[model samples]
Target chain A: MPQLVTVKVNRPDRRPVRVWVPVLPVALVLFPVVVLVVLAAIVACVVFRIGVVRALGAAWRVISALPGARFDIEQGRTAVLVAIR
Target chain B: MTEQRKDILDMLVAGKITAEEAEQLIAALERDQAPATGSLDARPKGKVKYLRVVVDATDNGEPSRVNVRVPLQLLRAGVRLAALVPPQALVKANASLSDSGVPIDLTQLKPEQLEALVEHLDEVTVEVDSPDATVRVFCE
Candidate 1:
């Protein structure tokens, strides 16, 4: 995947910090998984009479907090702060 | 009254207050008005449409601005997809984050607990103000 985000952090009296966050490989790896999981979650929600969006939302919560999972999280607050100013 | 404050009143009378002094009056006439009601928690809740980041600043004496809108659906999809990354990639990301002084262990991120966070974030607005710039991130 190409670099979707190229953070060019310029700080006075120091070399700039260039961080390239790629998006394509991540998308490639997750597309199939998202398709499968979302479909199953939707089906389960329907069977149990649960709202589909709610069920999907619940699943997202679980997945986002999972160990090794924050692939989609915004950048670290501390990191971004340091980079900005 | 200070010249600025008196000018504010004059501007109001002259019908020019609508341009700038309208809001400036609170600062000029009522210094304590803001602190009396400076409560973020008191802000009303609203449906979230997008994750937005806005920056207004100057670089090298030139004005610069950035406005970015991240669809919530993209975040949802990305979180859902993280579950599929191979263990090797997770290790690499974890090491990289730690080495960069971020102190976050991606390997320990749990998806189950992420829902509560995302829900709360839907109501969050982070505003960063500095001498040279103002930045804000919020869901709206």
Candidate 2:
């Protein structure tokens, strides 16, 4: 069996943020934070659907291209595996 | 037909060699067979423009996945943007996998902020090595 090879091309933007420093007091940073927080929430929700939740989407593409081989996304990277004989 | 010629073309297509190298080779061949032209210095030198990204994965006891290559400029922007985000925000995004070392909720970043970060990216460049073919992001 041909070993599996997974290739992941990082999107121009991939990894998420770690910390959340206000740089200013809550009162001062509230407006920007609110906007950012709202956007972040929307983005986070979309990411689950676009990045994580849609597992079968990538697999379907791989399956259509090569029936004998399988492709899927784990985390966010592309995974390619060979079908058993 | 010659192995040397084949190697040159392969390298050119693979972006391993500059346009000048191919041009030099062609010039050398031409000079070898026929009369030389005007000044060779006048010839255009082609530099490799597009960046390369290579990913190699293996499923052994190690079970390693290596992501090689990132456009230096784009990476710098990513790193800078990564720095702006605090660790708490990452944890909040529920995407922090510290051992993996990549930032959390990155894909969830806002489009405007992301675009702003990348706008200045042209001024910076970086090369990173990662186990999972991800853009580099370090948070303290």
Best candidate according to DockQ: 1
Task: Compute the DockQ of candidate 1.
Answer: 0.05
- Those runs of model 1 whose alpha carbons end farther than 4 Å from true positions after fitting are A1-85, B1-45
Poorest lDDT segment (10 consecutive residues) of candidate 1 chain A? A76-85
List the per-model TM-score of the A chain.
Answer: 0.40, 0.24
Interface RMSD of 2: 13.4
Candidate 1 lDDT by residue in tens digits, B1-140: 65766777778889975856567665655775455566565676676756778887766666666666665655665665554444567788888988898877776777655645666778789999998888999887
Q: Interface RMSD of the predictions, in order shown?
A: 10.8, 13.4
User: Candidate 2 residues A1-85, lDDT tens each?
Assistant: 1222333333325653222222234436587877786567557646544342233333333223332222222223433332211
Error of 1 at A77 (Å): 30
